[model samples]
Target: MPSSNDSRVERARIVASFGRQFYVRTLDAPGPDRVAVTRGKRTDFCVGDEVTIRLIGADQAVIERGLSRRSELIRSDRYNVKRLAANVDQAAIVIASDPRFSEELLLRMLLACATAEIPALILANKSDLATAWAAIAPRLQVYRDLGYPVIELAARDHPQETRAALSRYLTGHNTILLGESGMGKSTLVNTLVPGAALATREISAALCAGRHTTTFSKWFDLPSETAPSGAIVDSPGFQTFGLAHVSDSQRVHAMPEYTELIGGCRFHNCSHIQEPGCAIRAALESGAIDPIRYLLFSRLAGRD
Candidate 1:
């Protein structure tokens, strides 16, 4: 039996969210997660959010308010903003050689991560496909040269090697996994979190939405042997990653190659597209910056 006093408030971290329903694990005690919801139309909560909750019953609570977030990854279009996760230490952008992952989407995700002040790494999955790997290896090098760590692994073909290669990165940090469909993101999750499949099934059942695991975000704790203090949040796979929420200046500064050349531009408000003496364009012409990236930037900046 619980009391009717205000002493029922407890700190909790959101572990899963689907639609307006959220599942929060109490930080004050070790117990099963409680289904939580905001008072009114407050639906801003996302997986990995730490919030204060008031227990209304044995298996449910009401989210009182959210704590300050250290970092948040978001994607947006002209109409809506989609929050991916919060309080994550870093992000792992998984891509595969087969099915031809979109570099544009990858860039968008990197930009979002950069704007959110979250470090990102590229996981080049499907390394066992030698022919496809050969074709994309050079492109992967481009990202590596930009100072992002790129780890190659075949999630499906070599589970042990994949786990070993990613263990260091996953240790002691809360990582958010993002990737498009067919990139082995799910396979990697199962490899790192052995019980992830069963957990997903349980989450789906708890949410009363069968077969909706891939459409929602959920958190999984890493095994103690693998990562004592680490956890991973698996987000739904999507083809498009928008950045309409990011301002132009933020986007420009987010690019590693353009950071050093920013002040070199002639005009203080140079858009870097048609502006003469633009340091970015100059670098592009001088072979100092990758042409493909520059083209992508131009397109994103609406100059192409």
Candidate 2:
């Protein structure tokens, strides 16, 4: 029996957002239900935000303030930036064999993960597609070689294996699930968190794209035998993951493999493309850097 208050404050987490309304789970409550909350007109909130709220009714609350975020995941377009989730422990990037995997997009995601100081786990879904899987195996290997955890399995076909591989990361941290539409991210979520019942759709063979099933982002708590409190932020599929917030230096720093040669470049502002005595180019030729990655850096940095 909670009462409305003018001065009382309670800690909570924003588990979901709907326009001006937010669904928050109160940490102060003994119950597990969420209460609808609203914030000041200028204040914004995203999934996984820890907030302080004051009760207005039995089932309603007003957010007083959001706690400082430990981490934030954002999506940007040319004009605006959209915060996807906050307090992320890691990013589980899902990709598949069909519709031709985009190496450039994967690199961008990895860069985003790296810049945010979030670890990345690459999952190659649809491994049941033998031909498609075979084609991408080499690229997947490259990611594995670079030290990011990589796992390949069709969620539906290898549920046990997939679960085992993901359990280590999913058991104790708040991971954000990200991928292009039709890449089976929702399906994987369904497999990870039983009773999630997230809607999923098949990829259109004609377009090789999946229907957008998830309309918004929400946090799902994963209760496993090992870690009952682990959670993941499920996000809608993205056609493009924008990095408008990341600066040139941050982008460069995100490339972990390039760290060793960063200060070795001939010029402090060397574009890493067509620059005389560029350390990156030297590393590319010396087999110290992955050629594919260097090419992606060149293109993403807008180098000739």
lDDT of 2 by residue, 1-304 (tens): 5434534678988877656667677887653434555654744688899998876655567888889999988767678778878998889998899865688888888888887888899988998888888998989888888888888768977777778878877887998988887788778777887766632222122224345567667787887763456898777877777787788898888887887788999899988988898998999999988999888878877421
TM-score of 1: 0.93
* Candidate 1, 1-304: lDDT as tens digits: 5677634889999999988989999987887788888888899999999999998767888999999999989998888888899999899999999987898889998999999999999999998898998999999999989999999998887888887888899999999999897787778888889888887888777667656338788888899777778899888889788888888999999999999999999998998889998998999999999999888878997421
TM-score of each: 0.93, 0.88
Q: List the candidate 2 regions with Cα displacement exceeding 4 Å.
A: 1-8, 198-212, 302-304
Which residue pairs in model 2 clash with each other?
Answer: none
Candidate 2 weakest lDDT stretch, 10 residues: 198-207
Global CA lDDT computed for model 2 = 0.78
